[model samples]
Target chain A: MSSEAMVVGVVGGGQLARMLHQAAISLGVRVVVLDPDAGCSAALAGAERFDGTWTSAEDLVAFSRSGVDVVTFDHELTDPADLRVLERESPVPVRPGPATKLLAQDKLHARTTFAARGLPVPAFAEVATAEDVAAFAGEHGWPVVLKARRGGYDGRGVWILADRDAAATVLADAEGIPGFLVEELVDLAAEVSVMVARRPSGERRAWPTFVTTQVDGICTEVILGGDAGPAGLAERARELALDLAEQAGLTGVMAVELFVTRDGELRINELACRPHNSGHVTMDSCVTDQFEQHLRAVLDLPLGAPDPLVDAAVMVNVLGGPDPWDREGLTDALAVEDATLHLYGKGHRPGRKLGHVNAVGATVEQARTRARAVADALGSP
Target chain B: MSSEAMVVGVVGGGQLARMLHQAAISLGVRVVVLDPDAGCSAALAGAERFDGTWTSAEDLVAFSRSGVDVVTFDHELTDPADLRVLERESPVPVRPGPATKLLAQDKLHARTTFAARGLPVPAFAEVATAEDVAAFAGEHGWPVVLKARRGGYDGRGVWILADRDAAATVLADAEGIPGFLVEELVDLAAEVSVMVARRPSGERRAWPTFVTTQVDGICTEVILGGDAGPAGLAERARELALDLAEQAGLTGVMAVELFVTRDGELRINELACRPHNSGHVTMDSCVTDQFEQHLRAVLDLPLGAPDPLVDAAVMVNVLGGPDPWDREGLTDALAVEDATLHLYGKGHRPGRKLGHVNAVGATVEQARTRARAVADALGSP
Candidate 1:
């Protein structure tokens, strides 16, 4: 509350941190980002750079020594053990703490916690053996989703088992892993995500639930302000997300991914403890960009208003295709009226989240169509 | 062009350079900035920092020695001799080249050039002595505008002469300055500026001219995409600017300041070779931001369209007020539904350009009103 500038320290120097750096700079706040590479845009955007792994205790200690007001992350892979150490030794605040972050970091734990909280989750069970998977399928019916309990992102660690034979093969391969979660494969009409920001002071706010489209389990596009569900469902989803944040002891931006079935039933799918790809559209379409709000929440400042600035906004991820990443045709892409492109300074890897493009339009479908066209022009699959 | 990355060097570290850096990054290009400070935002934006004076030949040589693909500036204050040396030795493209930059760098040269080109400009003469000022005013006018030929900006280095007596006082006090221009002071109705981008390939584009309001010679606000003159006059201004660019062998974004007299005649007032303050609203209001277009033009990329995205947009500068700058009530400014605030990370100084706020509305006046309210809330004078 004082007139002095606030310094926020972010862990991991990925696109999320790069955006947070941009947001902090806009508000005249300084950010210190500790990343594994110095070439990341986060470092380029005036964040005091310290190169090291986030999992290293010594590096975290050095990062905490910067006298930052708060510490957050661009990725959830931050070592929980190191965070626990930081909470005790560092003077700066750590949002979401280790407990809430663990819920989202580990798939098995997230399911258990949501189930215990009496939330609307798909029918699920944690399995360690083929028999356990078969038994769960026998009870919940066929065609279930098998997921790794940790470190899966962008459609990397999930598989659908339509029958007992496939379930046997998947479970046999999951022997050494912590465990796998089996969930009913609900027939979904669409997927949506509600991004919310919460502070330790108990203030919470959520952006409008946007209908998300995914291909092969990787989020491909987001349609803002859509009528994907029944009337008033967005508000309900926000309430659920806020409640979940509180229950999970979250203290920053957290995205709750949800499924809307053919019957209009809403189900909580998963959660991300930091800025989500689904919220990337906010950089161009929201009154208060989500990254800025995240910094505000984590720094214990008053939460900003979460209002969509446009009637419809669609964000399409620029995932790398089989072809080499040439960044060619960007001139044509930039020629799109009202198009905003954010390229993460990440290396080219097939199906990797290289960047995203957001387009604002009068309708979600129109925005989505434009966004997809731009993404395709940028070599998206 | 080869797909390999290339570097562009900028000679200043102001907000224009900062925005240009952002634009360059989107095109997969890099920039090296030579600012006088180490911790400036442009330096942090991956601009390899070389801190020194812009007018120093040694500094310019050091900056030019880096083999940067091109050398440009956010502001046109480079010493002419140093620029000429760099052009001969390094062969890096220098936009607005040295010849056009003088039209802005030296008021006397600009006036004479405007007259020679048969463009509409105020009646003016180079005043080496107070007698010359008196003669010029006696011949064409009573009140006159006296401006120092170089090294003045943002209301500085300009004086209004009411009569021979006032002119005598300024000339007596401004002894040995050697370079001053006396101009016929037109009874102005409104002020406007046209922002145009030109490529080395002879391609040129211009954004709509907008009426600007000034306080104490510093621009207070801009009303974008509004008619500042008749449609025919506006088109003429754009053509004249493009013609001027071609004549001067200039390549990059250029802003032309003009006066629309009560008689509906438009006259050239001044020229800015870099991104001007009047173009700030283009960051959020235009299809291709002026800063981005400047990069595209200088890099020889095909320029994007310069269409206005909104019906009207207003940009209000956050001028430092009389009261010591306070961070109080900034949240209130940030809370405005349609206002976008951009704060430069600089220590406050009286009458300094810290940042600006932009707003869009159905009408120019409405947007201007909202922008001013936000700037006022941030303690602008």
Candidate 2:
């Protein structure tokens, strides 16, 4: 309660950290980011940057002691073992602790944890060889999903195998490595995600569920509305997310990616234990955006309302193209009715996420059209 | 432009500049601020802060040449001669230039300029002696308003005189100095302000007129609604602001304060040639906030829509109180329905502006009550 503002240290300096720095400015909170990349998105906002990698315990512990009140993450890239060292040595507490972050870092660990905790998850089995995958496919049907146990994101260490031959090809591509994880491919009616903010006090709130669209395993758009997909499921999705959030012991904002099956059941897909791209729709519509909510949660301050201020909102991701991200259409993007554009200060590479456009209106279709217009004007990849 | 984000140099690091830094982070723009105080409000945002004063011509010119695409003022504190040097010597354009900024720095000059251009203004006069004050009072009324010709804000250097006796007391207090300006104290109605963003290309846009409430010469609350004041004068106010924006050649956001007469004419009162406090309401309610609009305008990219996204919104200034500002209530303030709190990182001193809370709703009264509640929770001065 002193006059000095609270300082929050972020582990990664990506778009989440960048948006957190922006939100912190108004709260009078000082944000310090420890990212090895000096030109990281957050460094552009002037968040005092420390040159350190998130995975290095020595750097994280050293960075944590340098006047931070608490430490949080923008991504789950830190080794849980390293973070345990941080929690032991640092003066301030590490949010989500090692256990929660372990779930985010290791997919096989999270699936087992969810299963043991009675949380809904797709049928799965940890595999160590192609024969194990073949057995799981025989039980759960073909077109199984193969996933790395750890350190893979944005569709990178994931594979879809139609049968034993395809599974053999994936194993061969991986130099015949036997270790990986496989799961039953749900009859997905739609893909949805929910954002939850939980403090150590066990105080938590959930943002409206978002129905997402994916292309080639990468999220392309996020939509928020009363009837975005399967009828009357938004409230149930939020409840499901909150229940799993408690099980995950998530701190700050966590995105619970879920698969809504055609059989009317919600099955957990993956856990993103941080402010996520799917929640980007909240930035332009929610009463308190997820970035601010994350700060409040980590600081253990009173939580903010997670409800949207608009009827519907949607966000379209802008990816880098063959040339480069053309910000020249910024004016035209702003000209789109009810559209707001946000571009990350990053160098363009083909198919890389450069930024996003959010639009709000009375209906999902109306919002989606305007948001698409802005992304198209910006030459969306 | 070649995949490069534009850079802007702001001459002052107050709350306006701080808010601009927040807006620019999302736009991928770089902001460089020149301020002598290492701990100015904007410095906390991590904008690259240059150690310099706004008044020094050497500093102004040097800061502008530091690879800025355009230079803009957060306040009109720069000496006009000094800015003229910056305009001539620096590669970047000085928006609102020396001539436009001079009018903001010198009120007497603005009144005279508005008078000459046939703009709506109260009857006024230039006075250098007690006799001149008496002559203006004789024509206008017994009681008149006196203001300093330049360098005054937030209730400083302004006096309301009752008669010759009161006038004599003010003169004696000033040691017989008579170099000031005087105006007729109009029969009261209401006070309102409009913000305009004009690009060098002559493209301009005006935000909705805000009816503001002042307490002892300090703006306490700003209300935005069609019926905020007597009858419907918002449209007329916007037109008048746009007209003066062209006359002033202002290439960024300009706030024009106006006084409504008991009978129904809006007379121009003051000009703030940068992002002004009256437009702070736009941050929470408008499609394009004034801070972002200022960047768009000064960069000459394109003017944004200045319309409010909500039906009505209101902002209450949180002034420093008896103790230091209690950001402890940040949680409760945010809990106020539809309220968003913004705190300027300031060392609190009684009567100094600290920050503001904005709330939006279906009606002005609804928004005001919520905004007031948030301000009260924050221990508003």
Candidate 3:
């Protein structure tokens, strides 16, 4: 690796990659983004662009040859097998190597691995047919959550089935019964997430646990320094996240989403091994943001302090609304003294994550109110 | 101008422009940098590069044609006449217009204007020959400071002459004796600066005053919020900066450097109508950094709060050492947990500004110590 100028090759040019590219500039690092679209968000942010898809080995190899020191991913959609091949063929190192990346790509694999390690996770069973789902539901309860093992995001690959008939209908519509998993649906009071950064040397650090609110399976807002749940929930969530990072041998930022059940137990819901939406508040509220931390970890640099710079911070997503774009009210949003707006350079589409607003205040409620106001201003009228 | 995505055209691509581009990403503003060097620091950070010198009117016009909404500058090295021509020719508006820009480009003009407005300034006189210097020294006392009226930075274009013979020697060495100004050297106890952002609408905001320490006329460290002088010093500095911004019709970030006398009086020393090194600490220590404020002011967006995020912050510049580059000790520097490093992507040269390290702590002493340690580790062996 050239220490003069470290070049990181990211496999996707989404908002995560775009933010990483922005953070890289301060560290004197260069980011080369590999995406099929030439005008992806990262490209607009000035990352060196390589026209290629994540699944194409030839494109990945070309990107690696273009003077990149390390290869990483913005998302976990790339096949682990393809990454392994690239790792063996490319000159640069692939961070969060195939083994670690696969842990996040496949839901069944992650659940089974965590269970084997005696982690607190939802009761889960692999599903091949409607009978498998029915049997799992019979043991767990009347309602169960079904999730595809891979390639699903937002609300795309998850479903809550209350009975065998519902499972049968889902199964009948599937093509050749795609790989899936069934889990016992726990009674949730709130959802929280902990973000942790782990280097290849086994060094790990985590941010304070923060509460997240999702609407229609989409992250609508994140609240930090708020009443997350029962006492000790934050500590327990942090411990769980750190342990997972170590177990997975993660070499970058990892977000551990947890379900805070009504019974006060913490259950692992999902894992994302990249800069996450839940941690977006860190951009304005933390001493060192998650994107910069991810870059430092993947580069094996010493970790920065993750201390909060404010008493409370809240982030609200600016999901694309009915209008193509609503920038007229941007001035109004900017009127919120502490509201910091970030817009992903993307064409507008209903429900798309166009941007987000962050606000810091003495209390989480105040911060959230200000952030939501800015988000509302930026949204379609 | 498309509010959907504002494109700001910057006239220089140095470290200031590089930082502005980094800040622009979070604000969803695209920066088109017009610099002669294709590999300037801002270009390396992913800003759109328009190859052209600051003096080339054609280049400026071409840059404005590339879908820019407003034009700004990273430095005051541009010829004011060219800016005036570009203002008349280009479709986009030129911020800080040519009139405001001229106030910063010519030191004599700035001093004259400020002095005419009853600002507190050292006694000064323009010099055309050694006789002029001797005459000014007769009134101001020995060891008067002589400064070139334009294109001077760091220690360049500045000299101190103790007598007529010393002044005669300097004038003899000068190439055609550039336009110079003589000022009485003040018995200064410390140097402090206040950074303020102004819009064309006459709205102005200033950050907390900071103390700057310089060696050989180049700033080496900036300390914020601790022993910056008397309690009212900050308020006075802010008032002075705001008044200057208003009187000069300044737009964007303006830094007013003041000399704090041993007897507790503040005197204006210099003015920079862009992000200054004195405000670099704001990147890691303030709620909203100066670079972001510059972009906001130039874009006419509502200014953000400039509250300090910590009790104190210290920023130490990483002046280039004997070595062309220093990477071996980066890991050592990274050992300082709260020390954030910012390296401009530039080829190293002796005494050049390569980067800066910032640290925040409970006290300015603690932050300065940490920041200085990191900077030392990154310096020459």
Candidate 4:
């Protein structure tokens, strides 16, 4: 806002932070990272890192002392009360304050807010008892989806209740966690996500939503410049995301996941208030990469053009298999022409997200063709 | 020769290493950097750094321990004897070796090599005595160029003998330096540099030669994809550089600095056997940047397409001024649309290489127009 390079203090030590660091370098800004781990990916930029957690008030005060221009996150699990307190005494601004971040952090709150706004969403209700789950499933005709309200990711807190019997089994697993939400399982044609950016000044820009393919409930690939539904569906989804961001007072990057049902209607599925994997392909395919756009939005800089630079771009997640000790496997995958491999610098474990690979070419099929080859190399025994 | 990523070990820590680092990232190859300074630009890539003197065998041995696929340099001033000894125990290979590197390191050797090969070079002789200088000056007329055989840069190791009295004053500066060479000064109309890359398999690729302008002997700007002179001049410059590379057995990026004289003849002014600053504009303008080409050649990877992406590109060097500070002024300059800035992360000093800014657009004049604004911002008092 002051026409100076804004210093962003990012909390979390992961690949997201690492990429944000790279984007900040190009903009001539410094990123200060707060992570307890020394080998965090963001440390490669040589950004100042305080060894601590986001919930530590001492750590927050130390971060505040670093002369940061703003405070943001690589992941959206920050304590709302902590953020609320920090905003009162912070040296810099905190984005998506307690009131708004809750809409993303708490799944039940997000569903309620969406339904309250008359947005098209699957019929869902907060479930605290077996009767609540039974009634919702009975009304929805069966096989309802139950999800934890918080602290869930990568399909971990979600379960599909085949019937009342299956609901009881999953209820034992959801034991002490916050209240679960029961939603009618819409017979969806495909799952897609639209990534959008918004400045505090009310400016919004959307990237072309892409159909996503998943494996074992984890996102496996993202194909840009395509929506399984009609062209208008993508635009409609983008409009919904923008309206939701404005209503929720969301700043920076926000992702709206959508499901296109058999009737061709777009319904809100889930939401992430920070940069999402669905937008990773933008790093190579878009004129202005999404991570950089997030930094610009958070810093309140003028938004940049978000047009696609290629016809289509496909991104495939590189998951770690058992005994994932091979480096050449990844290198061999990269040898394919026009393929870019990004390793997340994480130790490998089965089903863990080590990194992702992106390919851009003449068509979605062409990009996906190359992307499959890269994914095979990662999963190769 | 294998399809494995060839590990290139580059010696010296400067802006060249920084660009080379960026190039290596695109190729998915690891570069081991040996620089005495911890803050060397190439260190940004997490390139293994052995911070020690060029003459230290311990440092050389440390570099050889992990085994490099090929050892090259960002600076050609490395001691030839030391390099030759290290090659024996090298884990992988060293490109050019001591013999070829010396040609670029010593002006006397370079001139003799060119003369013996019957290549076009200015009339010159080693000035061991005043008679040698006087005879050459008498035959060539006034305004001969005097250059030290080693250890000089940015016009510091060379002098212009405008007249007999001026020659006497310049001769004193070259006194302590070894083997000074005197050459007839050509009435140069323009300066251009030809950048060519040679592979171990005798494959060679040449980038479009561009006109280079210098201020105070430091490269100030590059006009990429421009017709520096006539078509014939560019062809001749390319041919001369290729011939020089083949003759010297150079197997990496070679830059030939040429002078187009009033008579329309091209003469080799100097040569650099590394990623030259004159090619920096290629990073933003060329389809395959010169650094990527250098990495390809050194790694023996399949060369990439080297066509120009934009019609024109201009590179403006950010030389340090009397003040030590961040590039706030330079950032302000990039407020112009379509400008890309590359900072080397070096400490500020008077007359030091800090970083560079580039602009690529539809026309040479347009690119230069925008580039000058950024450069002016960086160098403004």
Best by lDDT: 3
Name the top DockQ candidate.
Answer: 3
Report residue B13 deviation for candidate 1 (angstroms).
1.5
Superior candidate under lDDT, 2 versus 4? 2
Candidate 3 TM-score versus the reference: 0.97
Q: Give the TM-score of candidate 4.
A: 0.82
Per-prediction DockQ comes to 0.31, 0.52, 0.57, 0.17
For model 4, residues A36-80, the per-residue Cα lDDT tens digits are 888676664345577788878668767867888888888877776
Best-matching candidate per TM-score:
3
TM-score of each: 0.91, 0.96, 0.97, 0.82
> What lDDT tens digits, residue by residue, belong to model 3 across residues B1-381?
113678899999999999999999888899989998988989989999888878888888888888898899998888777888898998987887888877777778878988898899889988888999999988879999988888888877889888999888877887853488889999998999999999876788888999899888988889888676777887988898898898878889988999999888999998888898999999998878999999989988888888887898999998777765444577778778778989898887767788898898889889988998887887732
Candidate 1 residues lying further than 4 Å off, grouped into runs, are A1-5, A44-46, A200-203, A225-239, A242-250, A302-306, A309-311, A322-332, A335-337, A361-374, B1-4, B44-46, B175-178, B225-249, B322-327, B361-370
Between which residue pairs do clashes occur in model 3?
A: none
Model 2: residues >4 Å from true position, as ranges? A173-178, A325-327, B1-3, B173-178, B325-331
List the pairs of residues colliding in candidate 2: none
lDDT of 2 at A213: 92
What is candidate 3's lDDT per residue for A45-139, written digit by digit as tens? 99988889998888888887888989998998888778888888889778878888888788999999999989889999999788999999888
Q: Could you give candidate 1's per-residue lDDT for residues B106-133 as a string of tens digits?
A: 8888888878979789888888677899
Residue A334 in candidate 2 has what lDDT? Answer: 67
Itemize residue pairs with steric clashes in candidate 1: none
Residue-wise C-alpha lDDT for candidate 1, range A149-237, written one tens digit per residue? 88888887899988888978876676556668889998998788999998887878889888888888888888887887787777788
